[model samples]
Target: MIGLAATPEVSLADEPVRIRAWGLPPQTAITLRAWVRDEKGDIFHSRAFYQTDTEGKVDLEQSEATGGDFRGIYPMGLFWALKPTTPYRRLIKWDVMGSPFLVHLELYPSVLLVPSEDHLPAVTTVVERWYVAPGVQRLQVRDGRVRGALFLPPGEGPFPGVIEMFGGLGGLLEFRSSLLASRGFACLALAYSAYEDLPKFMPTVDLTYFEEAAQFLLRNPKVSGDGVGVVAVCKAAEIALCMASYLPQVQATVCINGTNAVNGNFLTYGNISIEGIPYQIERAQTTHSGAMQLSFTLQDPRKPEYQDCILPIERARGPVLFCVGDKDQNYDSLFFANEALARARKKGKQNVYLRRYPGAGHLLEPPGSPFCPVSQSPFFPLPLMWGGELVPHCTAQETCWREMRDFLHSNLAPGTKSKL
Candidate 1:
């Protein structure tokens, strides 16, 4: 039997998170256990066990890959040490480290009473065939002369609109945005830097450009035109938050793994340059031993200069959804969520929904890959290393998908009560 809601003081970092194993006899092999996963829900955590001595000392051991993280390459032999393995429950596993004699202990947030109703959709086939479903329309739009693709649901006299942003490293991946558009939305995947002729490197981004994009989406007939919603990931997350604060057309915003404040220098799109961004971000470096490189802003979060970035969360005119990963080494998703939530509450706003996963990392969506962080894979010392573990049986992937879908539906629903 395993302990329920047991809080273990372990941080799942670059190396496998270690725990102080208790009640082990010296000179004997005992199980070492732990639980971890990444955002995409494709990988699982494993427990490798080491032997113990008679002096009540148990070396952290390894075992077979017994939990959710290893399902992608399972049965024949995923990789597991002779260490302790975890048991599976609610799609999450805290390893007894695959030891036949097992026990599980977990802490808050990592422990959710997953209702059985929320299982992975039986449609297990990979998404290969792309469809321009029921209400999707192709439109070439410009934000201050920068052109991008837009997808709007047909037959909508007036519907909610959303402006989506991909990572600094990827292109306008129309596949996912089109899916959202099919679900009755005016979705646009916009790119500002890194790709084709946009900009040679990560250029300074402007909140006004997204503002213009929102305006363009609202003006479209398919969109409700009242205002549009925004979704952002990685570095773009902060820009989405800024959109909600500075732009009137933005109603609901979802931010994942992004900077909370405008700590970097302002980005210039076209000839117009927006200023006041603190130049404080520093990038992390990675190592061959699997440690990540980290880049972050130098501005202190506690200072007034950084308040402009913090002001948006407090001033957001619409609802917000934040998805954070506890083990995410880059973008401190959990911390950002809490900070934003606190700021919102201080301003007497209560419409913030924050979801936290223990081992989920950045870059788990819209193209999750095997790289430590696919963006940093090419760089020698990968920047902003993270530690969110992808679970097997697709727990993180499935759960995050469900939570995010519900959040968008509930908040951005058609004909809800919003003054806009």
Candidate 2:
């Protein structure tokens, strides 16, 4: 008889699982495979080759993968190393209120180059990964102009508030915000464009709309803070910077792998309008995979003509955390972050912090999320190369997520007890 098991079987998405196998031949070579289907029905899977111990047991916590998707003693490697069955299909969870992802684990008798349906597995098991913890509440918000889903932690008198925003992909993304609520934050996954009745594209960004969302979050009876934090990635990060600079209600900002300048859209606030930095699409290179490498496509904002495009982040009333992936193929995120740092320092702002991750990508999601270096873009004809090696990128995601949570707790909640 053979057995495979994942401890607890069900847990939060960020929580680690210990996988072990037994009842195999001593010192036998075997393959461990993990597979899960996304909300869109796209399958993602990973496999690793390992050798059993003298006692005929294999523990992911102790054993190292000798071959396959990843090497080394990473207990959760099977989760993060998952690659799409079809190229350029990024894994995204659209339904946070639904059932958790059912990850199927199988132990094969031999080391197969690809998962074979022809042969039965020696052992099989399943694990459930959930974004929302038990008792967390999810509420849809269609107030005024704010279109989002608000996630509130359970047993809360009032919780620290955070507004989460995603990039140019545009629709509301709730997975990260839902996970934040599980960690004791009242988070709003806000959508600016391409969702419901919102604009189809962001040709002009109205800072007033974000201001309205921030105001609405602060007015919530379940939200404790007089001010809120904004966590944004990609093009939305630029909007976060703008909010931090212009909105006094935005007390903290987390900018992840985003530009410091107005990007590809005019930012408007009353009489103030900042022109977007121009993109040299002609300079973009197409890789052999047919994905466009856009790292060098955006014009430098520091240039004399584009100086006006740079956001005045020194005007921000609170500390700003800038997280950048050094190997970001989406754009020069490190360069933009450093430029923002310099500009802030020049204006005598001392609360700005920069965290740089080596070999990481543009989509630095919460831990346990798959590492997608390239994926098809909803806005583009071909795929986009987001850029990063799997191991280092996954490592960065784990580390960055912890730090980001701590940062939010310290700045937004202060004396409040944290569930993380």
Candidate 3:
């Protein structure tokens, strides 16, 4: 008989979950694989081969994970990085419908073989919720015009507050916000469009609405600090940068795989109209597998009309952290980050920082998320190509996640220890 178990039983996504196997044949080589269903009901699987010791036991912690798309003793969240061979099938799919992806992990023993339903071992299930954390409370946000959910950590007093937002692929993305709360930050997943009671699509919106949301956090008694921080990914990063520049209450900004210039169509504040940078779609060369591939290439920002779209980082109240990937397919994120840094430096601002990861893709998710090389279009079947290989992507995710946490902690809750 072969037995497998994951230590700690319940593990957070940013944290590692150790797997141990015993009761197998001694000194024999075997294959182990894991299978789980995504929120879309697609079954994804990953497999690896390992040799059992004389004791007929295998501790994954003691050996490196080899013979798969990833390798290393840990490989920084290998469990979550197992993606489907079919493109556009993401390994780490965030729930945009305000629900958590509950992953049931099953380790199967088989011959040195490929991953398939037939090869899956008949065993009991050990389940783990992907982004849900203990003691994190999710509250529906309906405060007047403000929308989305608020994730509050379990504490009596105030905590550092953050307003989390997603990019053009709009929806109520609460996983990251809720996870941040679990790590001790009061996070509000703000939805500007593409959800219930919000705008059906990205449109010319008022920046004052966001300002109102920030004011809400600052006024909340449970929220610590005099100002709030903003965390955003991709297109939303542009919004975050703009907010930091215009909103006095926004003291810190985290922009991940974002553009230097404004990318949204138009942002209005009274009579002021901020036009965004324009971009042309460049479809990636599709492979024989018929996988979807798409990339957005931005036009020249030096143009006279585009000049006004450049973000004024010198006006920002606090430091900015730009986390970018060199291989970002959506846009020139590295170039954009460098531009932001240069502009801030030219303006005599020393608080601007940049972290560029090689071989990493457009999406810089929380640590331990699967490396999604190809992104599936939410509205259509065409897939968006996400640059980067598995190993470096995993490493990038871990490193970026750590740096991001530190950035927020230092800016929002300076001199305090990480709640990890």
Q: What RMSD does each model have against the real structure? A: 13.7, 2.1, 3.2
For candidate 3, write residues 1-420 as lDDT tens digits.
Answer: 768777656566677667778887787666666556777677666666666788987787786665664556662344656676565677554662345445455555555455545555645456464575667778888887899888888877588899999878787777788778888889999999888888877767578989999998888889987788999998889889889888898888899988777764787776778877655555345645555444545765667888889888988888889999888876678888898899899999888898989989887787767777776768655677667777677788889888888788888874442221
Q: Each prediction's TM-score against the native?
A: 0.62, 0.97, 0.90
Sorted by TM-score (best first), the order is: 2, 3, 1
Candidate 1 vs candidate 3: the lDDT winner is 3
- Show the lowest summed lDDT stretch of 10 residues, model 1: 120-129
Cα lDDT, model 3, residue 112? 46
Misplaced by over 4 Å in model 1 are 1-135, 154-157, 195-197, 267-283, 295-299, 366-386, 392-394, 414-420
Write model 2 residue lDDT over 108-193, tens digit each, in one string.
97898866679788889999999899999999999998899999999945888999999988888899999999999999999999
The alpha-carbon lDDT assigned to residue 202 of candidate 2 equals 86
State the lDDT of candidate 1 residue by residue for 56-167, as single tens digits.
4422233232233242222111122111122111121212112111223222112122413343221111111122453357776665645567887777456667788865
Clash totals, every prediction: 70, 0, 0
Compared with the true structure, model 3 gives a TM-score of 0.90
Error of 3 at 193 (Å): 0.9
> What is the C-alpha local distance difference test score of candidate 3?
0.75
